[model samples]
Target: MSGIFLKQADFFETNGILFETGGFFLKQAEFFLKQAEFFMKQSDFSEESIVKK
Candidate 1:
């Protein structure tokens, strides 16, 4: 459980960095947007599974 939580936290942290950096890229920021969206979805999925169990 701790391992999963840590992994999720890391993903969220990376996503935050990508999102912040994306601000400077303007036209090419879509890549970071996609990355952030993917991580966010994964985080939500993890939370939902934890809740279910």
Candidate 2:
């Protein structure tokens, strides 16, 4: 009985760790995507200014 409970607890702990790691990676991906979008917009603006000139 105690052994089964211990196993269940261990499984939950591992799953929790995996979830936390996934969340961290997701945040990093979002940050990078935002940075890429910002750079793309900046480039487009520069291109427009050059064209106008």
lDDT of 2 by residue, 1-53 (tens): 23444444455556556787755555555555555566667778888999999
lDDT of 1 at 25: 44
Candidate 2: residue 35 lDDT (0-100): 58
lDDT scores for all predictions? 0.59, 0.59
**TM-score between model 2 and native:** 0.61
Model 1 Cα lDDT, one tens digit per residue, 1-53: 34444455555556657787634444334454555577778878999999999
TM-score of 1: 0.49
Candidate 2 — which residues are off by over 4 angstroms?
Answer: 1-20
Query: RMSD for each model, in Å, please?
Result: 8.4, 17.1
Instruction: State TM-scores per candidate.
Output: 0.49, 0.61
Off by over 4 Å in 1: 1-27
